[model samples]
Every structure is written in C-alpha cells, then in structure tokens.
Target: MGLGAGPPAVKRRSFTRASVAVAVAVGLVLAGACGGGGGDGDGDGDGDGSLSVGVLLPGGGASRFGQFDGPLIEKQLKRLCPDCPAPTIAATSDPAVQRQQLESMITRRVDVLVLAAVDPQLLRPSVEAAHRAGIPVVAYDRLAQGPISGYVTFDGTTVGRLQGEALLKAMGTKARGGQIVMMNGATTDPNAGWFKRGALSVLQGKVKIGKSYDTVGWRPENAFVNMTRAIAALGAGDIDGVLAANDSLAGAVVAALNAAEVRPLPPITGQDADLAGVRRIVRGDQYMTVYKPFEPAATAAAKMAVALGRGRTVGSIATGTVDSATTKNIPAVLLPSVPVTVGNIKGTLVKDGMYTIDQICTPALRSACAKAGLTR
Candidate 1:
C-alpha cells in the first residue's frame, strides 16, 4: 500500500531464539493482563480483562482471506489469550458492508479490531469512529486510512517486483523487445497502485506496455473483459506477456487468451499463490506466482491486536513503521514474499506446509505434476 512517503525498506526479520523468547514473554504478559475476572463478560466499556476482538475481511470461501488468513489469525489469537472472548469475524467484498461491520464492532465497543479493508478510502470514516470509541484498529493486509494503531501485511512493492522479474525471465528472448499487457487490481485498494508502481520500476524500460487496465473490484470477470479488449486492440501475436497483479486476474487473462485461440500462450505473472494459480502453473497456463506465507502475517497481526487490547505498545512486535494518508509512523510489520514457479513449487509452497503434494497434484494434474518433479 502507498504510504505518505516512499515504500518502507523491507528487511527480513529472522525468527531467532531471542525473538521467540520475546514473543513468548509478550504472549504471557497478554494472557496475564486478560485472564482477570471483572466487569461485563462482553469485554465492552467495563475496562475488564475479557479481551474482545473483531475481524473484517474483503472476501470469503476459497480466497486467501477465507481459506487461510481468517482461520490463522483466530488460531493465533486463541493461543495468545485463551481466556479472551471468542473473536467476532465477518467477511464481505462490499465496502458498505465492511463499514457496517466496523460500525457494529464499534457499537459493541470491542477491545480491538483487525481489519482487511475492501476499500481503504471508503472505510476511513468507520475507522475514525472506531478510534472515537477507543477501539484500536489494526490494519491488516490492506492499509486503511484514519488513526490506526498498527498494521500488518506483506511488502506490496516486493510482491510486484517479483512478479515483474519473473515475467521478464519467462519471456526469455522476447524480453529484449517485448510487448506486455498490465492487468492491475482495483482502484479502491491502495495496494493496487503500490504493486503497479513497483512493477513499472522494473518493466518500464524493458518492455512496451501495449495496454493497461485496472480491474475493478479486483474481479476476474473484469480482468477477462479487459484482456479481451486488449486482444482486440493489440492482436494476440503482438502481446508477448501479461503482468497480472494477482492470481485471480492472471486466471482471467489466461481464459481470455485461450478463448481468442492464441496458439502458444504468452507468459503471465501473478501473486497470492492461490491453489488455482499453482495448478495453472503446472498446467503451463501461468508462468509464476508470489507466495506470501500466511502464518507469519496472521501471527503478527494477532499479536499486535492483543497487545493493543492490553493497552500495550507494539514497539516490541513491529519491525518497522509506515505512514498512511491520515496516520503517521504507524507501527507496522512488513513481511516478505517468495516467488513460486513450477520449478520451486515443491520447495516453497509444499515445503512451507501451505499445501500437500496430493492437494496440489490432483488426478487431472498427475502427468503435469510428475513432469514438474512434484511427487510423493
């Protein structure tokens, strides 16, 4: 996401023995702070230890936010504060619905909120309302504007760079003088702009951008329409590669190209490392994808939320600081992302415990999986 200044420099934070010890200590402190018995059980305005958390996500069901982030964050929260009330989780792609969810959390006077905003700008007022209610809002994945206490997400610029570099590498001889179509994410999410900027830094001089379109709502259908338009404007042969912002968009681009009957598919880049994206890579429809490990990100966000709930600063948890449009130098955890291609799928995705060999290698993809050296 775009910050007030330039993107913060991303330094890999190793989970050393000392870091683990610190994390344990922090968790213990939070547990002790929240284990007391007093005030209303809802953990509302009574100023008791009954920690209450609210989660807002962009989408649900098979999407990363649904399949991974939500469950992982909840799991981490329970581990940290077993006595705390079960968190209230809600998911929606509509900015209006997300705002209503935030308001509901505010009305309940939740201790803290972990939000993955659908539209950062649109949710600014709701975030402000949460702040007014003395509920600390931790911006998760997408940076929401307003007075947020902390933030946690993967390095968007790095994600874009990985996609751009992989696309160029996949293009091979065509890389010297190639034409590419840029299928970016939604305009409402600042991350879309952030990814686009980073990709342009690497792709501006190397390739000719024949067409570029920002897919509204980050929807695959929108991307498909845009890709079809690009094909009509710039013939399939002239389009050498596609720099799609995420896996969903990349799938749409691939489908559109296939529908147009492009003989040999062009190299396409994606992020999020969704299972479908990995399958596409094995089937030779997509070139690569960026995998932002969900465990670390969820853990970081959960810790930040719990600490804030206990009236503690996130100085111990945050690796760096980021400035949003309305908030300055907010405590932030900028995690790293890994690029996944057919060559490194086993080493990155499966080896990291994100997916099993059998999960990625379904019956239909057995031959392709074998060719890619992905076996039991």
Candidate 2:
C-alpha cells in the first residue's frame, strides 16, 4: 500500500517494446549467472520441466517488503515448483525502475511474471507486452490491470474494517467526543480508496475528523511532514487518534506526535504488523497493527505463477475471484487479516511463526517484551 509511482503525471509515453526489452534480457542473463539456483524452484521438485519465474516488487524501503514478502514468496515458489528456474526477484523504489525490471523479465521470456506494481495503470502496457509475448502476468498484491492470469492480496475492505474497528476500540472513553486525523495512503492506489471507504463506513459519524490528508507516496517522511502540519493546525491536545494506512505511516505519525510532546499519545492504528510497530505496542507508544499472514498470500501467488507458466489454468491456485475497475472477474486469492494489539502480540505474530521472540525483543526492548508477557 505504501508504493506510489507519484501522481499519474505524464501518462506513460507510447511504449517502445524493442528498445527496452533487448536491454532487459541482457541484464537478466548477467544477474542470473550470479544468483546461484541452489535449491530454488529451478529443480522442479515435482519432476516437471524446469520453470522460469520473475517477480518485481514495488520497493525495498517499506521494511515489510524485504523482510516478509521477499523470502516468503521465494520459499513458496520453490515448494510449489522445485524445478522452476530459481525465481528472479528485484526491488525498485520508483515506477521507472519497476518498468525497467518488467521489460527485462519480458525479454528473458520468463514463463510467468509476478508483479506488485508501483503504479498499476502505467505498468499496464508492460503487463500487456508480457501477454503478447505468450507470457502470463500474475498480479500480486497491487492489481496491475491487463490480461492478468491471477491475483493475490488480502481483502482490501476487510483489512480496512479491521483497522477501523481497532481504532474505535482503542479510542474507548474518548470515542464519544474525540476529534482525530486521518493519515491515509497514496490516492493513486485503488486499495487506498477501498481502505478509506471501509474505514469511513465505521468512522463516519462516531468520530470527528479534524484533518485528513492523502499521503503523497505512502512514505513515512511524507506522513511525518503532514502530521507535523496537522499538529500545528489542530493543536496536539485536541487530536484524540490517528488512522495511519500502514505500519510505516503509523510509525511516522508516532514520531511526529513524540516530537510535539503529546503525552499519553492518542490511539493510532496500522496494518502490516511490522516488528518496529509491534515493539512500539510493547512499549505503549503505538496502539496496534493488522497482521495479514504473508505465507498463504505468497504461496497462492507462487502457485498461480507456476501454474500459468506451465500453460495450466489457475483453478487450483485461486480460492475465488475479484472484479476490478478495468478488468472484470479476475482470478484471485483473497487472504484474511487479524487485528493485533499489545494484549495478543504473542498469540498473533509470534504464534504464526511470522516473527520470533528473539527477532522482536532486542536488548533495548527486552524489558518492554517482558512487560508484554513475551519473555521466554
């Protein structure tokens, strides 16, 4: 949700397939030579022909992208198709970088390309190029419009409602008369709008929205600047809560509040139970984060990509389908999310094997972890 290719700006110039594709292929061959296949899916553990898969992530800046999405996806791809060419993966912080990565994957003629687009519309042509090349593109996380063979992401509305409900609960006695700020994600992302709509469904009349801002790039720094402005306009004491779209933005919000010296900080909500966010909850700085298990979601995407690569239907890969604005009734894997508060940090993230106690409790947070009942 943090990924934004900036504003629509100049719609992608007419794509030059031959120009970008050739360069991309050369780059891939060089990178592949260095990325030893090892036990990666290149082995076709299932005794099938070797498969080649490519994955392009939006950014590595969002800690979750590197820490959770990357390894989980690589591990699952190998489990689903041990003989597939070791999966090719890369991260680009900008849309232009993602476009170059897309073209390279296409040039390599990968069996399937899995993308968590930085900007779906601009990436549409690249996805279409893959389609024309007889390659299927599995839209992972953010839906990239095209003849997408499959889609995998947590239910957007459900994730939003969970965040909303948690925010209200955290507000407790303040819920009745409190005014809060809404720090949402980039408007370019359809998921961001879905999150806002779902949250408004519950937050509409119950709480007074003092100020709302659609974050520029889902960047913490952007959220920080915006939060600082909100504090200046609304005064620190009057704001009772914050609705940060994700853990990254939530962290920014908390930092801004801390700078403003907001004592007994107001309740804030976030998604993507990031370790820092969980640690903050233990120390009682932030309120909660939504834990959307990465394993099942990653597994579903890998299975779909492998199935598509082998010229098979996504029947086994999808639990259902979703209707997108540009595309109707797309094959999809809808994952569930759980709201995580200080009281249940262990029961959710720790128990799910998402993060170990050691990974979570550093020397600085050791005491806080103990206070949260996480001592082992």
Candidate 3:
C-alpha cells in the first residue's frame, strides 16, 4: 500500500539541508520556538506537560513506515497531547544517513524521540549522544543500542515461530527431511537475528537447509539476486521450501522461482501482512505471513514517547522489560503477532478492518478468490 499524505499537523522543512539519499524529515518544527522543548522538566524532575516528539523510521515511501506506523503514531500522539506540537518525522534506510538524521534531531533538541533505527549498532553512538543531551529516546519497531528509555514492538521470536510453523505445515510430506532455502533479513537489524534464531529453533532438526543467505540491507533486489544464486546452486528441484524474512523478500523469491521456470512452486513463508502478500497467499503463491498489528504497536510507542517527554516513568505503561547490549532492564511493550493465510485472511486482516474484500480480491483474482473462499 502507498502512503496517502503527510499528517495535517506536519510542517514540511529540510532537515539540516543535507542531501543524503533516503534521509527525509516529514517536518522539523523546532521545539524551542514553540514552547515544547526537550528536557523541559522542573527542578524536581517532573515535566510541566509540554511535549515535542520526534519520529524516525528506517524507511519511507511504500514501506510500512509511510503506509502505517508514521500516520498512526502522529494520530496517537495528537490524541494523547492535544496541545503538543506536531512531531518532527523522518525516514531513511541508510545507516550513516540515519545517524546523521538522529544527530540533527538532537541538535534541534526535540523533547523525546521515537526511533526505528536502520542499523541499531551503527546508530548506537547517536543514540548515546541523544541520551547525553538529556533527551529521552523511545525505540519503536526495531530496538537500538545505548540508553534507550522505552521500546514497543511485536515479539520477533513469536513472529519467526509462526512463520516456521506455517512453512512446515505447508510442506507436509516434505517436512520430513525437506531441504529448504533460508532468505534471512539484513544482519544490521537486530530483529533479523532474533527471527532467524526463533525459526531455527523449530526448523533445524526437522528440515535440511540446502542454501542460506542474508539479504544485504533487506533490499528486494538483493533478495532476488540471492534467490537466483540459490536456484542455480541447488538446481531448484532440491529446494522443498523457503523461509523468507518478510513479504517483500517472499515476492522476490517467488519471482526468482518463476524466472527459473520452476513448476509447482514450493511453500514460502513471509511476514508483515502487506496487501500484496495477502493476495499472494490467496493465489496459492505464498504459504503464510505474520501480521503484526501496527495500530497497537504505534499507540504503545506514542504513549511511551509522551510519558518520557513529560518526565514520567514508563514503568506503568510497559508490560515487560528487555535488556539490550548497552542498556539493562529497559521498559518495553512486546505485542503478539498473528499468522495469516488464505483460510484466516477474512477473520484476521479483513475482520480487523486492515483490508476490504475488494482490496484483496481484484478482478483478475476473481477465480483465485473464489477458490480461497474469499467473497464480498
């Protein structure tokens, strides 16, 4: 899905006027001039309720950041603090560029930052810099290193478990010593390792992994290249299943398989119930996808950001605690994820108002929709 438009509260402006590719700040409304400065706490360490939230996502455009997380965060922030200034939103997939954006935000001195780091370890120094500036940082979606104040995300372990379980079920007879290819996400993302570990816990003893590759930058093009190489190395026929990290990767895998003219495609697992991924499941191209409801995750991040900005403890809002490489016992809200397939598409995505029947079932997919039991 594509992003509709920037939130009405957003004010467009150049972030440091830097021409870094992929680094875009939706609007950088300075907090100092608007009476919503960061670390605006009283002598007793309690804030006067003035908030200026800054949001930074890993990517933009058709990515989840633009399509769901950004808008939902803005809405929730507005609901919680009506008088607060609009957040300074930014997105970039380049690690160096993301670090530059975070440094710029610190210079601007936003009250609290909501961050989904492109590369958690690469962004650690910048996160530390923000902490030293007395600006509380709330890590959203992906966890970053250094003194992060709060975190909100779906459990990566559970997401992988669901994907692994679904892939095995789809493989059926092949699940007994089946040889599969592993298309894992970028190593820069901590969640990638988390997901891979969770999936390996369930898949290791049951299946034989023929070829495995880590797609650099989590880029679809890289996935395609890797998949093509795997097809050439394994001769396509030996590959019984595929464990794709997400929907985008799954699409690339499918395309590569089709390019190799592999008839009767093997089962493929995916995550992030993107519209296209859901339709792929209906068409019997992909096996399943893990749906991490964006609303609750965004809302939780907004709540944590607001509380941190107001100089309040997040202990009450956090359901649990997580320890990062640098920080110990960090407050967190790890939500659950649901596995989506053709059978559960209606009850999960459609029933939750994520998509309409018309959206998933296009005119070209009429017969496929009928076969999948999807009807308006």
Best by TM-score: 1
Residue-level lDDT for 201 in candidate 1: 86
The lDDT-based order of candidates, best leading, equals: 1, 3, 2
Error of 3 at 310 (Å): 0.5
Clashing pairs in 1: none
Candidate 1 structure quality by residue, lDDT tens digits, 1-376: 3441244333444422122224334334333222223321112223335689999999889899999999988987886677777899999999999999999989988999999999887899999988888999999998888998988887788778888899999999988779999999887887887788889888988999999998899999999999999999999799999999999999999999999999699999999889999999999999999888777778778877877887767765676787777777888777667788999998878877889989999999999999999997
The lDDT of each candidate is 0.83, 0.76, 0.79
Query: Ten consecutive residues with minimal summed lDDT in candidate 2?
Result: 7-16
Each model's total of backbone clashes: 0, 12, 1
Error at 121, model 3, angstroms:
1.3
Which candidate number has the best lDDT? 1
Q: Write the per-residue lDDT of candidate 2 for residues 1-376, one digit (tens) a residue.
A: 3223221111111212121223233223212211123322232336557788899987775477788888778887776666565789989767788998999989988888889987787788898899999999888888777678888876677677878888889899878768999999887576777777768878888999999999876889999999999999999899999999998899999999999999989999998898888888888888988887776667677767766776667653455676655566677766667788988888777876778999888899888888899966
- TM-score for model 1? 0.89
Q: Please give the range of 10 consecutive residues that has the lowest summed lDDT in model 1.
A: 35-44
Per-residue lDDT tens digits of candidate 3, residues 1-376? 0010110011112212121111111111111011133442112222346578899999888887888899989987776677778898999889899899999999999989999988887888899999999999998978788899988876777778888898999999999899999999888787887788778888999999998888899999999999999999988788999999999999999999999999899999999888889889999899999987777777678777876876767775565777776777888776677788899888778877778999999998999998877887
